[model samples]
Target: MRSRLHSPTVRLRRLAAELRRHREANGWSVSETAGRLGWRSPKVSKIENGESRRLSADDLDKLLNLYGVEERGEREALHRLAKEATVQGWWANYRDAFGSRALPDFETEASAIRTYEALVVPGLLQTPEYAEAVFKGAGLTDDAVSIRRLVQARMERQHILFRPPAPHLWAVIDEAALRRVIGGREVMRDQLQHLVNMAGHHNVDLQVLPFSSGSHPALSGDFTLLEFQDPLDQSIVYVDTASDVRFLEKPDEIERYSLIFGRLQGHALSAAESPVYIRDIMAGLESDDRE
Candidate 1:
């Protein structure tokens, strides 16, 4: 049975895929395999699906034996994967802020992140004040403490961009998001300046999709596509909605989103031109403040 208490981490997912592969290679159906091991079918399903909290060494050994996996090196590798899957990531410490969402966990391991934002700055690029404004705007809660906690969690997530071998971030933001004046004139100004500074980062590529771009492929909404260095950890597309977040991993879905993101980049202002466009908007905000 799937355990809500234990959300699947990437390592766990990788291990699960390996287990499923081995079972398929053995040509044993889930029911047939469970029958051989005296396990209920769902128990085998849980492990293969990465829904189990943790797979004990004995259970893994039994499955390996059942699959005729006799190589000492292969056995040790699978055992190590099982052990690693049970370990919690740093994001687990902020459960109150993130709940069951696993985006941060995956972002920590992504080698490249391509994102399209229709109505706000991407979390990784948001300033503390702007982030606070966003949370407040969402009306997610009235509790000040909760808002602060959420903002803190967002700021912490940005640490990945500064770490060694940082992931490349290519963000395409719609013009409406930039003109929305998210945290009032001053906050918005500072936020724009922050964006200008971040755009200069070697790993960050910021592009603006102007209003003139007109009805684009991603007009449906915002989404992020995360790619990993490891072949086993396939690319995933993440969509965040008001009520729930969806992680799409199917090959077709990945391909579709990838094509959409490429089109977004194409429609957006070039990286060199983006900063100039932003500064002009900042100039307008400043002029309005003067008036």
Candidate 2:
């Protein structure tokens, strides 16, 4: 059990996994470890399973001591991670705008992001007008203030694209996304042009899943696979549905999503050819505007 809603949430899970690993390495069961620390047995399980969000440095130090971790460097690293796990990220400020799982926080820590969008442009690449339209169409709420907050939060999430050590983002967008005019034709025109510009970036790989590729992998829906550089921290697959957001970390699930994403990349246009394909679409949209 894990709460991977935010960056700190993921960090917390990693910390818990580490503690559990160390405890088992030293031949300490949860009950035995809790007895040594003078705590209830369930408390140890809570800490190791990431059910406890109140993980503190002092608590971590005690666990390390009980586990007989003599290495100072290892101790300091775990301590730092513990601190980070509890710290609130920028997205925390917009709690009302987000659902249970914090997508922005996960994006911030991911080293590479692979996404497949079947209907609309991915959030990271959406323009303000396009984003506003998407939100307005969702019928989430009628409150204008709440809508603005959600849009702003999305725009803020895009900042990671320009930050130092930006993550490699590979997005496979369906051709239908281009034809579906959200926020009117002008808004979509600008959005398509934006895609062309973003594709030129070294870290951005944009591909169009052309209509010609029928019955391909990922026909069920859209999903994102996030990869981390650290071996200790495993990759994750995120799926957003009408009801809720799901985070998949089990090895088999991750492998399944990875395979699906791989097949998607195979079916989509090559990154090098995506820009021209987009430009041609833009031309078609322009021609339609004249007629």
For residues 44-163, could you state the per-residue lDDT of candidate 2 as single tens digits? 999988888887777788899988888999888888778777778888787888765688878887889999999999999999999999999999887888889999999988988898
At residue 226, candidate 2 shows an lDDT of 93
What's the CA RMSD of model 1 in angstroms? Answer: 3.4
Q: Which 10 residues in a row give candidate 2 its minimum summed lDDT?
A: 1-10
lDDT of each: 0.89, 0.88
- Residue 7 lDDT, candidate 2, scale 0-100: 77
Which candidate ranks first by TM-score, i.e. highest?
Answer: 2
Query: Can you list the residue pairs that collide in candidate 1?
Result: none
Per-residue accuracy of model 1 over 136-178 as CA lDDT, tens digit each: 9999897999999999989988988998778999999999999
